[model samples]
Target chain A: MPGTRGRRADARRNATAILDAAVECLSRDPDASVADIAQAAGVGRVTLYGHFASREELLDAVFARAMREADAALDSLDLEGDPRQAMVLLIRSSWRIVDRSRALLVAAERGLPHGRIRELHQRPLHRIERLIERGREQGEFRTDMPVAWLSAAFYGVLHTTADEITAGRLDEADAPGALTGILLAAFTPPGQPVPTAD
Target chain B: MPGTRGRRADARRNATAILDAAVECLSRDPDASVADIAQAAGVGRVTLYGHFASREELLDAVFARAMREADAALDSLDLEGDPRQAMVLLIRSSWRIVDRSRALLVAAERGLPHGRIRELHQRPLHRIERLIERGREQGEFRTDMPVAWLSAAFYGVLHTTADEITAGRLDEADAPGALTGILLAAFTPPGQPVPTAD
Candidate 1:
């Protein structure tokens, strides 16, 4: 019984290792082959396929891992408070996670099917939608623009800011605040002063 | 001789056809081969080789053509008037051109070197930079943020809007105005009402 358990534990370790290697390899090259991933993982191709049926499956697992990490990152934020302040916190927190997973995100974007991409994005999109609705209810954000559109803009701006930071065009330290300012200005009613976040 | 002049005209026509084919093929498949482009252009591999020595040369021509088109699109914008209004006009005009060249832009983004990419973007970036600076001098925009940052944000927002529209996530009709509104709000000083373009 003890020997059987030990073998199972080893299998689990191998699966984890292979997944990590696949993520790293695919992030570097979205078209990386199963052989490349196996070599990166220090496992044979047979072992890699034994765990994941195909390359598509491995990509799905990578995307799932990325989604889980991002979900966990976002879940820690208190999205129920002063909606405006909550939004600023969310922007800063989500951006840090995004910056870490930048490569994987880009790879997933290229590798995932369009529907699958939308599916992966649903949770975060819903969270943003609720936050926008909350802000609208509190009159903290403009009511004329659709909440959905504002949410879309929120996601869009985060991505653009991330790209800027990655390209060395915008300082990493400046991104969150810069993003918060842009989002706030866009959401707040025209003629109202946007409260500066220091 | 008359025959030589006719042959020269034929060569010019072939070059134009080849460049257009490269743009079309690369836009569809960033990894498209020289042969694919030649086939699309209705020319043989030998003829393609005669016109461009290498695939890299053809890609450079494609990128150059894209840049030239974008520059012409931007040139038509009066970047001088009331800075805010001029920005609105510029966004609408630029987005139209951007919409047309979306495929080429994405292809160049993946194919060209970073330095080459920056070189291609120089004209538009400078145009935006000057517009932001003018807005600041006119007291139409906030002076706290660097002009360069504002220009970058302007470019970023436009690309985001374009992507959203292309993906069918945001409406095409709403794009230009939504873009103008978000950008103007981001650039304007706090407490000022954003001028509506409609």
Candidate 2:
């Protein structure tokens, strides 16, 4: 157990260092070479390969790290407030990730393994679903529509809002309130109380 | 006016021919060369230049044709039966355009003189706004949300659904219904009657 413990700790350290280097390289240039990443990580080519078999695996790891950070943010997000306000906060937080990891997203768009990421990406979405479900049960969200559809619509707005922010068409500060108002209007059940703006 | 009439007829024919060739070429390959387009249209490069001036202008014509087609589809679309069903039909028609002219969309995404095309793109969106406004006024759509965000959300879903279709993750036939359900849920006014699925 002692030897196994030491090996696990060492592996974690190397993985962290490699991911950090990958993030830096991708931020500067999405098409950064593996050799450059290894150099930055102060690890040899073989060591880097040992952790990630291919460039795609390395990129996937980098993407997963960003997603993990996003999930961590979700962990601390307060969803107990009025569902509409809560959703707005969640979306705004998600936008911060998209903004900071712009290069990673660009790379993913060019051609990253999507199947692997879809499940990881669905984590935040599942949380949104729960909130929508809560709103529905509380008579705040319309009961006629399925949660699946609401989730898709939520994702749709998030995508467009992110695009607007990236393209400098809309100020980031205004996106949360704007998107929240729209979602609230779209999702609020009839006769339910509307949440006051934050 | 006899000589003037002949000249006008010839100009109209040439413009129509240019637009037809542009649609064919852009749909097949958005990045197709101008020389190729001229050859396909049976016109000299100089004549093509006389008509369109630049690649951006030609793309603008291509997008205009697509938008016109979309607008025409809206006229024929039967959104009268049920709001949700009608919305689904509209989304389906839009998806067909995306499928048929994916190459052109890729070109648009790459960079089409955003100024005029962007304005033209908003034309259909403005029309959608009117539809949504009508729905809200009629108590079919939620009244509290800005139509602009809902419109953007619709466009975003269209883009993503198209992307999924292009990538083969989602079948084209299933997309409309799936997307329609989500949009209807998002847009239905609180306390308003929800349509039962057929």
Top candidate by TM-score: 1
DockQ of each: 0.28, 0.14
Q: Candidate 1 has which clashing residue pairs, if any? A: none
The digit string of per-residue lDDT tens for model 2 on B59-178 reads 777788887887787677766755555666776776676667666776665446323444666766776677788777677777755576567677777766665565565666666565
Count the clashes in each prediction.
0, 4
Report the lDDT of model 2 for residue A130. Answer: 93
Residue pairs clashing in model 2 are A149-B182, A189-B190, A190-B190, A190-B191
Q: Candidate 1: how large is its RMSD?
A: 4.1
Candidate 1 lDDT over A1-198, as tens digits, reads 559889899899999998889888876876788899999999999999999998878888888878887887798777887988898888888778777776666666555653475567778878988888888889887666656666766776676566556567777777777777777788876557755634
lDDT of 2 by residue, A1-198 (tens): 559889889888888899999989888877788899999998998989999998888998888778888888887988996876676777677767776777677565443643354555778768888999987777777665557556655765776676556556666677666666556655665444444334
The alpha-carbon lDDT assigned to residue A190 of candidate 2 equals 42
Interface RMSD of each: 3.6, 5.7
Compute fnat per model.
0.27, 0.14
- Tell me the deviation in Å of residue B196 in model 1: 4.0
lDDT of 2 at B25: 83
